[model samples]
Target: MTGAPTPVSPQQIPAAYQQALRLQNAGQLQQAAQIYAAILRTRPLAEPCFQLGLISARTGRRAEAATWFRRALEIKPRQIEIWTALIDVLDGPERAKAMAEAQRLGLIPSDKSAAAMRKALAELETGDPRKADRLYRKALEAGGDPVPLRETWARALFDRTETDAALKVLAEGLAKAPADPRLLLTRASLLETAGRIDEAEADLLAVLDARPYHPLAWLALMRARKQPPGAPHVATLEQRLPEAAADPEATRYMSFALAKALEDQKRDAEVFAHLDRANTMTRRKFPWNFEADHGFLRDAIAAWTPRTRGQSGAAPIFVTGLPRSGTTLVETILAAHPQVAAGGEAAVMTPLLHPAVEAWFSKGTDYDAQAIGQAYVAGMARKLGAASRDCRTTDKSISTYATMGYALDTLPDARFVVLERDRRDVGLSIYKNLFRDGTHRYSNDLTDIARQIRLFDAAVAAWRKRIPDAIHIVDYEALTADPEPHVRALLDFCGLPWDPACLTPERTERQVHTLSSVQVRQPINRGSVGAWKRFEGALQPLIAALDATRYDFG
Candidate 1:
């Protein structure tokens, strides 16, 4: 029998490779690329190869990017991102083959039906909404797993502003998979989104009835409806918490759910106890390394500095900040303008920037930042189709904050609106919401959340100092207090003519897919401001962490 392979130590990693990473982060792509190439000559590693792939892809060399990604995957077969990158470059049977390999390696959903649904979802990610719609329909007709397929399809339809059609799709899925907890939970979420609280509660309850200890179902139920005096679920959740101890994931969910239920009962101490327990368990599962995140910010700040101008033209607006901040609100407001279309968090910037950054850092080569910027615009234009050509578009991906330095460097004329909220409130909101994606794992723990917020604060502060002219900071509270003037200023900053529709963002006919969807559908209000005050006592650790940073909440 073969023994386990020896793990590579930090000492074993070439210093040049480490330098390349630092250079890449700093936006010195050419210098970083040179270092990477030299290291590859001595040792062909997956990481450097992946870096090369990113550079290739960013330079509009899709075919070369696919080749580099394939080479990286040959070395590290389990790299899911490499597979995704490969699929992004290839089409037709080649893309299908790569996806099948991903499925076979268990990089994606393993079940055949779920795998097919994942492929359909991936098409949506590639900016092909029509193709995605067709694939979803084909999957449904071919008897793909009723639950995941239906849930994903419904979400896609909802995102496209076909709310009634999405509801019909969910209803049909529920009819097929009557007792499926996932389907039930999805329907409940949709109902909640629609403000049909009682119906949402009923659906959540149905999920719990079928699977008594379903964590998500229980959490959904708790959020869907307020508990009456002496709520019966308190005792049930308390009992299940101990039973769920064996499964950390279940314990995490049950503890948070019970905490909310206990809060409703005004059991402050007990509420905190449950929250602490849940956060601890969840944090253990996904630990955060603050030093590494901070280092990236430091490098980014050092790398992106004022340089000679590049070609300029109409550029897309980037609405970015920490998650749970007012990014969605700003995006929605901008999108409401007749001259603006919502791109809905299209991840076009990072992929384009990564490769260019790597190449720039490698050898200080003069990369065409204009070409990169125009390529991103072209990609978004294709995704948005001909209709968006007449107007500007907004990419509201919160994580795009990390790529802002590179973004401004490449697209010199691009406008950025950075949203700010109370750090304490932001932390609390992140904890309370059950994020649909795995990107925000840090939100599961207060300490990690605080650390993350600090990282964002540092990056924003640096950007403000370095590129103040391009970035506009919008405070959530200030905007909520009086939106018109702020909206007008924001529009003017983006060079858009004043439009009354920007003031009535709620009436805008666009599908919002973020947690703030429901909140943004209404006029600005102070309801969410200072929301952390209720749990102030329980959030001592988070408060202390933020205090250490001495960041201005305003």
Candidate 2:
């Protein structure tokens, strides 16, 4: 074997190199490179060199990559693949150069269709959607079976808020690929956005019937159920919850749907149970609360929060708590006020803290409190996107503020209206509703749901002890019973002028997408206050831990 490591043939290595090329095409770059490297150790090949250049171009290694492409072009002067790979790695000026070279070498046509697609993809990547749209259209005009081009065009249109055009594109695509689940889901979402809830629901159901485990179908179905006025559909949703309990995605929508249904029935405990389940499952899947991993979050808030501090302008109002709690209702009420823009579940603050969290993981250091605060404000501004300038103040009702220690620290000048519903009600509501995301950790089991509630309650109590002055605890029972007094007090806390509409959140036309979507559409009813008492027989375990005497609401 020693001397025979002699002259390894290119034929002997082509199999491995070809396999590497396949891997590269399939988006498995690193593995392909390793195989290519192995082959190069035995023999040099033009195909592997060209493929390596393509991989390098994709991964942003442009300079070193040009050398590989040149070497491949030299070895196979007439190869179209080498010329294409070289052009792919080039920037604007370099692309022009490569194209000129290809033309001179007679390798590819100057205005070939592949060239247009490459240019279009590059434009799309650089954020020029309008130009990219035109290029994609051009690619279709020059082409073969323009369905893929239509799909991309539709997505771009949707991104640019041309919903009607987007719908038309996908609707036509659906005519061709009627059974495609993704197309069906997209078409349904567009329909829902266009306020055709009935049509959306039909398409969504068609998708689910074909692919039973489709999570988006379940969520769209839940949304559709909310739009309609009926108990039968809600009952159907309730039955489907257990069927979808095991899948985390399914459980979210199930918990959300169940909570909405139970709330409509004025079953407070059941509503709370389903809502809490949705929250638990969501948190378990993706731990959004930055404070859970850092005690400094609690510490930062206590230190940074000034006793006599006030916001300069109308400050951002945070309506937050457990998922099934009255966070959405509180926001609906608050948003009815002329001064506030209700920015639903602003997902900004968490992402701002992520890099710091990751740094802590890497460097074994503590999170910078001042940096976090600045980042939070900036993050909120970013999520506000277009609406940041529209209103004097905005409201972000992210419901996951049960772990608000860090978020409170970040927005020291902001006002918080913390909604506190009964623990049993929270748990029951969470268990039944299908939340749209994986944040419902308690969706499957009763025991875990209750434990998560206890955790949230403890966290909130700790926040009260730490920063009591910063938070206004709005009891769900009190809010539902006499909404005006609480609503007025909340308005006062936010430093806003009151409107009577705050007491009647139902009349607001702000697209309420929460468990209280239906309830918030009605007059504040007293029936929901202690309605969980009816289910006391079924919720014994939840009641045992959630001492009714402590709340003193009887």
Candidate 3:
């Protein structure tokens, strides 16, 4: 077919293969595939064939992927990676045969250290950091290569809210491979959380300098700083879109990045266009379970017992509210106080509530309140580590509304700061961003987002009647408009001394790993107070579904 393939140079092929890998990793799948195919045309390279198989398998073309992988195996019969790819794309007898052959050829690493390292990573995914740490120690003791798993291990530590420990892990990783893109990106994220934006920017820039088209790095950089008009990144992001279409992950990152870039240039229409497409895809993939969530809230409220806070190690201050309703903002303000630890999105309660909800809903049984309080206190203290000592931990867990009344008995000494915002503004913010953590299905649809707000309102109203003294209502609009008096009152309610530092939450170095991370990094301002007015007509469906009152939506 091509006059002996023009006698392609073997040396030229490996460089092309690497360039294809960089493109694939960056999520530029279409371009990556073109190069891979071109390389295959010249030489039937096992690497390109295997990569193409992987791409096909990931995109759900399993049969085609299997064919490509088999073709790759024909070139290098004992190629372990090719066999692995074939196994994943095959089913029934073929998969079993492939698996057996792969094992026979040592496809899966069976060594103790390798197995331990693998389990350590899996444990991290399942949120068992203790188990992961144990496994990691086993791997290290067995002399496994730590460099490969360093980024993941550091992220696990960060997930536990052990920021210092996470940074220490990154330091060790960077010491070994200072220019490792993955480690640098991870450390950059950590540094950003630590309020070292300049350092984070430096790390991101270095990564980009090495691999200019990395989508995730571009997304991270986009969030860290403004993408001004005529900036090289703006055009690069735009041009990368057609190529990124085949990789949905790449498409999502580039879409959001480009949207942010356009917004920086005041291209409102284009910004919304990109957000709409990206959020639509996100909603499709991560649909929120609205009914189960609200059902739990209702049951928890119905099954509420009039109990007070227990004598706790450190009094828990829960900043409860809807997403994008200034919950993190309030927590940052409170965390500025010397005696408060910033516990962003405390997840300790999530597991406890699910079973509690099921028991209450189906069996009319109540979860043990005293045990919940004790467990929450102990777990939260462990999560915050040294910061929990003599400090009131401000846990801005967004779903605390579901169990605030239950906490009256379970978490008796816990102070609840009920943060409220204008429904319209909340709607706008939630619609524009993809919530990576929130299993909030309601956020996918405009009407559902509106309905959820009213549910939150009703829940808070019920809590106010039951536990008014324990609840401190903070109106986000009023607080942002005039912060000093509200912050003083907020601190007084939690029995904390007034630190003027709370007045400037932007200066607070608390880690905010949420959609509002970038916005909350700035000083409190009324800029977002009524920003919804700018898009009123486009958001009419959301407005109509709010069951609007002049007081509520206006």
Q: In order, how many clashes per candidate?
A: 26, 50, 6
Model 1 error, position 473 (Å) = 1.2
> How well does model 2 score by local distance difference test?
0.63
What ranking of all candidate models by TM-score puts the best one first?
3, 1, 2
lDDT of each: 0.75, 0.63, 0.76
* Greater-lDDT candidate between 1 and 3: 3
Best by lDDT: 3
Cα distance off (Å), candidate 2, residue 262: 9.7
The C-alpha TM-scores of every prediction are: 0.69, 0.57, 0.76
lDDT of 2 by residue, 22-135 (tens): 687688888888776666567665656766777777788997688789888787676676788778777899889888777654445335545676677667645576787678
- Which residues of candidate 2, in runs, are more than 4 Å off? 1-179, 186-196, 205-223, 226-314, 354-382, 392-405, 513-519, 547-554
Worst 10 residues of 2 by lDDT: 545-554
Could you give candidate 1's per-residue lDDT for residues 457-495 as a string of tens digits? Answer: 877886777677889989899999999888888998999
The local lDDT score (0 to 100) that residue 373 gets in candidate 3 is 75
Candidates 1 and 3, the one with greater TM-score:
3
**Tens digit of lDDT per residue, candidate 3, span 284-316?**
657677666567667667766665444444468
Task: Report the error of model 1 at residue 90, Å.
Answer: 31
Query: Candidate 1: minimum summed lDDT over ten consecutive residues — where?
Result: 1-10
